[model samples]
Target chain A: MNAMPAREQETHILLVEDDPADARLIEIYLEESGFGDWAIDRVQSIHEALDQLAEQDYAIVLLDLTLPDGTGPENIRRIKAEFPDQNVVVLTGFDERVFGLEAVQLGAQDFLVKGDYDENSLAKTLRFSIERQNFIRRLEETQKIARIGSWEFHPDSGRLILSDQVLYLTKPDDNEVKDDVPSAELNQLLRRIHKIALSGREINLDTRIKISGHGERYFHVQCRMTRTSTNQEIVQGILQDVTDRYQTEEMRKARDLARKSTEIREQFIASISHEMRTPMNAIMGLSNVILTGDGVQGEQKQMVQAIRDASDILLGIVNDILDFSAIQAGKIQFREEPFSLRSVCRNLEQILGTKVKDKDLGWKMHIEDQVPDQLIGDKLRMSQILFNLLGNAIKFTEKGQVGLYIELKDRNAEKVELRFRIEDTGIGIPEESQQSIFEDFNRVKYQHKTYEGTGLGLAITRQLVELQQGQIWLESHVGVGTTFYVDLGFAVEPKLTNGHVVNDVLKSSEGAFRGTILVVEDHKMNQLVARKTLERQWPEVQILMAENGQIGLDMLERHHVDLVLMDLQMPVMDGYQATSLIRRHHQARIRQLPVLAMTANAYVSQDPQLHEKGFTDFVLKPFEPEHLFARILQYAPLKAIRL
Target chain B: MSTINTQIDLEYLDSMSGGDTEMRNTLLHMLAEELPKEKDVLAEAAERGDLPAIFQASHSLKSTLAYTGNTEAIRLNEGIEASSRHGLWTAEDQEQLKVLFERMDFLLVALRDLTSE
Candidate 1:
């Protein structure tokens, strides 16, 4: 380290001139001047001067204009161009000011006549030239970092000045030097900073600086105060944006967040596996007991019923999971129409009442008189919301009463609002879990192991409620009770009671065409359910059943059928094929006969396909009685059969 | 920490309405209610066989006994369960009878309450 700063030394010089002599004048001049504490490399000829300049960093170079190898100002020009940063003074025998000026203009610091010049004047010129150059270098450096816009600030203004390259690189910009700034943001940015300064608190401001050339730049301004300023206040520190630096930081943060969520999801999957397998094992064990004890006596049948109920609950939980994913994926569609609110409420009540009794908790419902007897909306989504709320009230409360209170509020010209409040008094939701109530797969904090649920109920409820332009919220105390509220809005369409709603739908829809019915299904359970429900509706109708698409085609070719209830997935061939074939073959009224598809797969978008295949419509495999009944009245009518 | 229903007063267990007649049936009933819970505790212990855990399980059993009214049976089993809990039991396998007696008494009480309800 000779390069260790502050330890470096300036070079000393020897100016050799021999001409009566410019040599004496040069020596005297450098000795007297002491520029930047000193030094010179002087030679009469090019050869010696080259050797000395090459040896060390010469503080200054004194040249004799008249040299043997390079004569006149030619020598000055060559040396001047080469060592431009080096301090050099021109010396000549004649006062040829023009020649001296020419040498000076070519890059020499000063020029002198060999006979006329004194030591002080020559030294002054050399000293001034070096000082001016140093100042210029410092000024150029200060402008570079200050040219970039935007900065990050500390909440408290604390500055730790260090000997880092960045420290010297960063500097304030002088408005005079830079002309290409976004004039608009200057006012806003300053105002924001000033507002922050007045707050006397910590804040991180993201400033988007739109410089003229660079379209837009983002900066994080973190302001911090170290100690008491004038009035026991803190110092605010700003960390300027290095967007180039921030991109990497943002990417790192995103990866970290992704990792955390992935870990949570993995944990959720693990819990699911445990929850599913354990219950299945229980059901399997119980079923074995029931089979073994077959017709034993009083309690044995009860035990069997209990086991069946437990399995049913487990199935329902799994269904909740299916619905949760379906809703989030936007696969759950609304079947728009009119339905009776009272009947829906009664159905929900029957479902909930038995559940509360099983848990040994009280169940109560208070319906508002003003609630329109019936309203039009998506009954499926509405039922999901209602079911979730009721389930929560029952699940959380083990000892106390679980009650539902419904009231109509905010009835306006445009819409009617029906609000339902559910109150439960078992284990109240924790304060921490209040925020997480409506979030997906979020159970109450300090959760119980005994309660079984998919944890998707509340999330589905929120989504469904929003879909209907309704709202849900809750209030609770730790050991007391939690009250949950739901508000639903229905449009200003004509209202119908449950009995009338069904009657009107069926009456208007039923046509005058009695046709033979064809049912196509592969799964035994679905097929049985479909057959039983259809039989209950139309007691005396002749029926033709097919297990797959091929069989269904054969039956259609052979038999005379008015309508078909078709299952989409089958072992041999599918309903899609059967319907397509029946359409393509162009059979008589039998071919034109309405064919309704049954499917469980949520992804199969049936609207376009159903229309394309020339089928009348579709029904999901797990058929509801009313839905099946209503749609049936549309195609094969009782009146037509009578006629 | 020995949550076993020991000191079984067979007369009191037998007095329950519709309680199990055989000792094995009684033990099975108690096992149905308590064993599952104990297994859950063990799963969650994070560090098993610790003094704190044995004490905690016994404490939980004290309430379980109150609910089932099997006080005498709990007292009979308490000594060995507590000894084992303190890590002082020399012969661990020999304590099976005490565990059985406690379970039987507990089952009798549970069956009685269930029948009455």
Candidate 2:
């Protein structure tokens, strides 16, 4: 008997009853139900019963469906609704079996007749119903998480059409939803197969996908090629939606990506190591050799000096990469101070002097007389960019002259414009190379070491110029030389026009563009030529030249311009970005301005869609001066950027 | 009781299983006697395809091999199962299934030697 005392603690009983007298009687039966260590709660209303539920969670709820507070069906619905999480079994005195069926549908775990309530039936129902409900709950949870589960199987027979029959045994009803999902799976599976053959060189792949939401279904996906007397055939590809399994795996993958940043870092390091090592080693080796080549003489000394300077150039190129990365990562530091432009130019010319002399090239620096002697800027950094441009021009030119031409364009009290153009006569860069030359390490392909470089000079120049709120571009033909230009902005004299040098000259004196000027610019040369030419033409009129239709609209924003010059392609924001912006604005400015689309993009310019946009005319370059001037006269009467 | 051949008389069934009429009649008899089915074979054959009927006939033959503890027909039938990827001729697919079937047939010699003992 004492041994029974310990086992008694293991017994658990739940009594749920609503009628005061009947509830007490059930509680009595629960404690006496041949089970020890039983917990019981009794209340007259379902609400009080639910309140007791919060205090002690029962393994089961035995309830009376008929109560003064609620009756047969209402009482059962209330109990089921309030404690849906609890295991519920109905024990009612009235129409017990009738309410039992209704209660079970309402999610009550089981139903018991008043007289039928016994130790055996209650114990069996509690064990079985709880197990079943838990299984159902787990199934729903998985369906909610992965949203998909699938399986892949390779059949022993190699053709799984036979296997599909096996799966049909499990999900016998063949449906069309299954059909669509299978076709998608088959395509995905075939792609995976081709990829594996190319990547891993593995032959077979059986892939499956499972979709979620009711009618939890699964499909078997298979792929194998077979041959007949005449030809090879795709054997079987079946997609059985094994929804239950796919959910778990995809959720796991998402969790993995969320947790692993180091993996991406490692991959990035692996890809860049080969590129970084070669240049770095050269710089390191050359520096070491220079320090040790002290006793070397004559031609050797000259060669060592060449090697040393080359090493410095290499290090500078590497520094450009590091610095650009820093700028991209938002870490570039700028120091602004007043310095002499003459010294900057002198130092840059000195750096390029030897190469110019070696090539027997004559070089000249022409500065506009009115250009400021003292400039406020990062002097060393500005010199570095100018040196890169000059050195590049000198290196590329075998014969004719390379000139560094600096001229003042415009200056306000707060800002100044200095234009630098480097002209070279050498093997000219082709037109296609011109577009991407400013990109890092980009150079004309098969460019021999005759002009040795890290190929970083132009790219770094572009970056620095852009950083200084300046623009840089090059124009060249196949045999003629290339001319590189830069426009730099410096802090102005800060006096506006009141005391600024020659107030009338600073008065935006006689606008450089007048009436209507047709701007024909497909790319660098056309744009620079058009703008500079139009600026020189009127000297005091409005000037508008667009790299693409998009910029044309931008020029339209504040100016009621007299003319539009459009280039079809440059880069993004390209001609399309420009024309579309114009078309959109034209909707607002109907016939207010005339837009002339200038292009080397032969087909896009002819596209019906181009004219449907806001372009009033088209000009092709090398366009005739008379044609451009004629268009200018035609649109000169209208307000520019109107629509 | 026909002595009930504790080993069972599966040789006749196994030998006839390659769509032979005699094997079909014998498989039907085995299903009627020792095996149980909820439906008839003709309806199943009509609803499914010839390959399934053939696989069923082979599967019944496969069971007969198991019951009698025989191995040769099991080898050829397993070979037929593998070779089915390239059709019955086993002419293509790098002849992988045919090779596998041959190896399986070689493995069956062990079963045959044991049954004789």
lDDT at position A374, candidate 1: 54
**Per-residue alpha-carbon lDDT of model 1 for A474-501, expressed as tens digits?**
9998889899889888765765321121
Q: How far is candidate 1 from the true structure (C-alpha RMSD, Å)?
A: 21.4
The CA lDDT of each predicted structure is: 0.57, 0.52
Candidate maximizing DockQ: 1
lDDT of 1 by residue, B1-117 (tens): 112333333333332212223422443355345644653552353135454554444434432343243545344335434554566643452353346355654565645544343
True contacts kept of 1: 0.00
* Candidate 2 residue-wise lDDT, A1-643, digit = tens: 0011223345333444544566555555655555446555455557767676767656666767776577677766666555555677777664567877877756677777777666666556666776876775675446334332222332232322222222332332454123212333344554566444334243533344332223444444443444456553434333335445666776888878754644454323322332232222322233233334344466655654555465456545544554454444444444455555764565455556667887899988888888886676766468767878887777677889999888998988777899989888877888977898898767676255345565666777787788878999889986789898899877744221111121111112112224544353433323433554344444555555554444555556755555556655443354545655655554444234456665432223225655456455565443333334444543444232121
- Worst-scoring 10-residue span by lDDT in model 1 chain A: A160-169
**DockQ of every candidate structure:** 0.01, 0.00
TM-score of decoy 2: 0.34
